[model samples]
Target: MSRDIHKKPFDEGTKAKLAIFRDYLREWLPVFIAKREIYWNTINIYDFFSGPGSDGFGNKGTPLIILEELNPHFDNIISKKLNVNLYLNEYDQSKYEALKKNVSPEKGDVRPYSIQIENLDFKISFKSKFPEMGNKGNANLLFLDQTGVKHINEEIFSKIINLKQTDFLFFISSSTIKRFAEHPSISRYIKLNSEDIEKTPYHKIHRLVLEYYKSLIPQNKEYYLASFSLKKNAGLYGLIFGSGHVLGIEKFLTTCWGIDKERGEANFDIDEDKIQKGQFDLFTNEVPKPKKVDLFEKELKEGILNKSLPSDKAIYLFTITNGFLPSHARKIIAQLIKENKIQKSSFNLSTKVCKSGALVTQVKPL
Candidate 1:
């Protein structure tokens, strides 16, 4: 059985993971709240594996974090006349009782939004609440902080994929998959071959697991997925965030890149970029970009010069699909124009650029 984390203070890895969760929710809430009536009439937030509200040291867990983050938005939510619901579920009985006590209104937990705490199994709770999530006028955010890798199987994942106007973040122990690649229990949920696991490097095990999940996405779907790996001693764990909208992707990427500027994907240097941090080229005496940045810029330059990326919209899609922020693409565009390799054109590389009827300018390659 997995160890009880609430029995002890949160370690560094757990703290980092919760920080990202908090940051992303901080970015997510306002978007749907501000869109009230215009796009969505309701906002639903679900935390499937919310713990006993905190660890042994009383640090806030996901459930408490959600409430705390939403506190400031109460006035806005009330003014906009939007309906916001929070569904927090914990499977363990002891934790469920503790969760109730922690967030009880008697303890000054009064708030503007509606909240429901459940002690049912995750699959059951998910099934009961999915209809509300699938409603066209509701915007949803789902958090599944499962103890192990078994909860989010292919069936549940497919259901999540089909939901519109929904964003999700789930935690997984990628190191477990790497350590037990050939084990029957692990293979029951993940179909990755042991040989492929052996080929991947230790730090990138999470990325490999993410690729397996990405393979499940249907060929025709336009979904955005990103990951942030957290390393605790020798063990590797991570969060996989998914959204079907460009704005959702932009907000998530913004939160991630804010935490990790080097790779924008991890707590530690997942790409081992320390060696190149301040290295200057002997010939030009200029600092070299990190490997990931250098590779992305090179690809963007080639695409523009070859006319493959011919417009602002195409470049915006390419930038997001390649796991980059528009600012990164903007830098390359500026450089290309200065070099006279591409003619200057008005560029509106943003989430709005992909909206229906948004103007897109052509990139004239000289």
Candidate 2:
């Protein structure tokens, strides 16, 4: 976890991505800070694995970005009997000290700051900070940005989901995982931890990682909870944003995705208004009805071995879901067919939340 040779100047790709993340946060925090009738006074942001702020080439970290935008809102914050708590955690003392100095005591009418620097691993630090969180009912939104998923697994994720009123936006940095996903040792780690998941196929592993967390949500009778996830890109990098509130999930996606350019690598098509307004809407669910899953099931049923030639229907659905979409019911059916592990007649819905986020309804096979 120490510094390495690759730590030269900040990676341009990562820096640009962070800029987009910060911009979205500024516009959206104001809305959340004052949106509800509920007296929203204290704002708590925990940045675990917080690296040295203002890294090489002056790439402002998330902590600084949050403070710059939020400090001004404190005018409205304390006026309404509110406080802002920024819990910045970095095991590296040098970096932590730098951050502490960066956002020190404020001037008159300035937002008051209470900062706690924990020189410990993320799990220990978070557990100490929010002991009640691992149980349930303590409202917290965690930002888990790690260099790798080596230490992050389902068990840790399970403990996090147990917290009531908690939402998580985790950066499952893929470059690290992709390197080890196919390794036998890594596969052993996953299989030993997740007994039901037999395949380590990238997307399936992605699904397993998310579903494992979802399973941790206490099956409470009074609360209607549907925990969900978001994967940024296959394994190179993905964010698993979990929320009990559906709207919060929607808002999270609306804010973060707005900043994403629809195209990749050599191509880019960022909506000017979205960019100017500092919003990320790349994955907004504008379509009224979730696209049908029949197409996905059939395509895979026929054959989806070739990645380059996605079936026409698959292409259309990909366009509909903005590349991240997948019809679980359809995929399950097709996968079962391909492997002879499941039957088509069993496709009749027995009450399951559909991927398009539609209500649990009886669905006949496509």
**Top candidate (TM-score):** 1
lDDT per residue, candidate 1, 1-366, as tens digits?
356788989989999999999999999988888555458878999999999999959799999999899988988888888889999999999999999988777656568889899999998999999888988788899999998798899999989988999999999999999888888889999889789999999899999988999999999999988888999656899999999998888888888899888768889888776746668888979885668888998999999999999999999989887778999999999999999999988899999999999999999998
Cα-based RMSD of the predictions, in order? 1.6, 11.6
- List the candidates' TM-scores in order: 0.96, 0.60
lDDT at 307, model 1: 90
lDDT of 2 at 11: 58
- Candidate 2 residues lying further than 4 Å off, grouped into runs, are 1-6, 39-41, 105-109, 132-139, 182-235, 261-366
Tell how far residue 275 is off in model 1, in angstroms.
Answer: 3.3
CA lDDT, candidate 1, residue 251: 86
Model 2 clash pairs are 136-164, 137-164, 174-235, 174-236, 257-280, 257-281, 257-282, 258-280, 258-281, 259-280
For each candidate, the alpha-carbon lDDT, in order, equals 0.89, 0.50
lDDT of 2 by residue, 1-115 (tens): 2233124655544554465456545645665565545334455667787776667455677777767767667656655555556677887777777767766665663455466
After TM-score superposition, the amount by which residue 240's alpha carbon in candidate 2 deviates from its true location, in angstroms, is 1.6
